[model samples]
Target: MATLSYAAKDSRTMVRRNLKKALRYPSLTLTVVIMPIMMLLLFNYAFGTALGSGIGPSAAGGGEYIDYLAPGIILMAATSGALTTAISVCVDKTEGIVDRFRTMPISRASFLTGHVVGSVIQTMTSITLVIAVALLVGFRPDATPVEWLAAIGLLALLTLALTWLSAGIGLVAKNVETASNIPMPLTFLPFIGSAIVPPESMPAGLRWFAEYQPFTPIIETLRGLWLGTGIGSSAAIGLAWCVALTVVGYLWARRTFKAGAKR
Candidate 1:
């Protein structure tokens, strides 16, 4: 019980420290917030006439496409937040902070927990900001209040999973540059999924991969929740992916942290 209490307290402290860093360096958080909105506007305006037509008539123009596009961009914001976690973790490891902590009597999980919790909170905020901006730009979801809560729940789960995955990537990275590069694929996932264009319009090969990848199911589930199409198996698959990734990420990250303990 004492050990558990120590772990909990340490984790909480780390969470506050990370949040303080985020507040101290507002630019990084600002960048995470702005990137998705920029993507939302750019895609909605610059390509909405051309690409929006492909999604459906409602998506063709007059900002109707923003409705279709909002969920995916919100997911993209989560990806951006994950990248921040990766970079921050890598910096600490590379700068000797992780090593110093290893030499201390700190709770083993606390260091990583701080980062994961902080990133989750930050990502959630970024998602909210993006959604609000999307609303301002005429994005609308027909989901009811309950459905909206459900969608937020899904987003929160995704944020937690991605942050942990990013933490693992950062921990295993050889350097800060490598850490930054490792999580790049996550941000690029929006392009390959149903975000920019529907998967049905893609080539058979690309379509197969897109439909099977973790991001597509998540995006599809989000779309279903927002548009009232029913999440169906997409929600199951998305949740499975989130659970699997969270488990794998936590395992590997815990191993990595304990490996440092042995050093």
Candidate 2:
């Protein structure tokens, strides 16, 4: 019960801290909000048609490329924000803020919890902004309210998983600059998957990666939910990826935290 209480309190405190920071720096918050929207607009309007043409008929089949790309953009936004989380945590570490927290009576989990919760909230905001812009640009999910909720739930899970992974990197990184670079590979993953184009049309080797990769399942699951299609293997694969990443990230973060505490 003590552990659970710590987790709850830490989550709340982290949320509060992040909200205060965002409120104090409205322009920074606005920049975060605009980046994804701009990316989506540029991709859909400027390059989507040109890219869609190369992917063949199935790519442009539904005439709803924006809807098709929404999930990917959402994932990308979440991934992008995670780098900020890592950099912020590293900044805190460098400024001796984390060391100060360590000396206080605060629960160990609370320190990490606050950052994770804050990062997740930021990711959610980015996701929502991207979705809103997608709607404006002609993207609509056919799912019911419940399905929409599930889709959001999946997105939240993915955000948390990635955030935890980023946190681990932040804890052990030698400097702020390197910490910021850790999540770039994750950010580019969805692009290589079926997010922008179907995997079927790719070369054999590229198709193999697309078929077996975690991003494909995540994109497919979101796409299936949006289109009201049948629940398929993609959902299972996505869940498996989340669970695996969560476990691995937890262990790595714990180890990194322990090592940093010693230092």
Candidate 3:
């Protein structure tokens, strides 16, 4: 019980520290807020009509594609948030902060929890901002209350998975710059998947990868929730991916951090 209490207090302290750091660097939060909104507007206006022909019409009924595109954009916001976590972790390690913390009696997991929890909170806020903008720009969905809750759940799950993965990447990176770049592939994954254009149009090699990769199933499930499209096994597959990534990332991050402390 005492150990549990210490863990809780440490997690909260780290979470507060991370949040305060973000507040100090207001641009971080601003970027988190603006990037997703900009992406939503850019894609919805510049490419919505063109892409709608390929991705399918909105289930809210019309050829308009913003509805179909909004979910993917929201998820993309989570990706952006994950990048911030990687950068923060990398910065901490590069500055010898992690080594300093190792000398203290605080829980080791506190550092990871603080970044992950704070990042997830910030990412969800960004996602909320994107959703509001998407609605203003004519995105619509026929989801019920339960479906909306489920959608939020899925986003949380995805965010947690990606956050842990980013945390791992951050810990393993040799420098802040390298850590920032490590998660770049995740940011680009949506593009190759069913995010903007359909995978069907890609050449065979890229098409096969996009079709079979993890992002497609996750996107497909999000698309299904928002637009009343077919989910099929995408929901199950997405959940499995989230679980697998979270487990792998958590293990990797803990191991890496412990190993780094030894060095």
By TM-score, rank the candidates, best first. Answer: 1, 3, 2
| Top model number, lDDT | 1
Error of 3 at 42 (Å): 1.4
Could you give candidate 2's per-residue lDDT for residues 94-198 as a string of tens digits?
A: 889989888977777776778778878877987888888888888877778898898899889888888889889888887998897887788778878887777
Write model 1 residue lDDT over 159-238, tens digit each, in one string: 88888889988988889889888888898797898888878889999998888889888887888878765567999999
Q: Is candidate 1 or candidate 3 better by lDDT?
A: 1
Predicted candidate 3 versus true structure: per-residue lDDT over 1-263, tens digit per residue? 99989988999999999999988997967876787788888988887777777656543245377876787788888788878999899999999998888899998889999999999998888889888888898887877888888889998998999999999889888898898888888876887887777688799999999888888888888878877788999999999998998999889888988889888
> Pairs clashing in candidate 1?
none
Which candidate, 2 or 3, would have the higher lDDT against the true structure? 3
Q: What is the lDDT of candidate 2?
A: 0.79
Per-residue lDDT value at 80 in model 3: 82
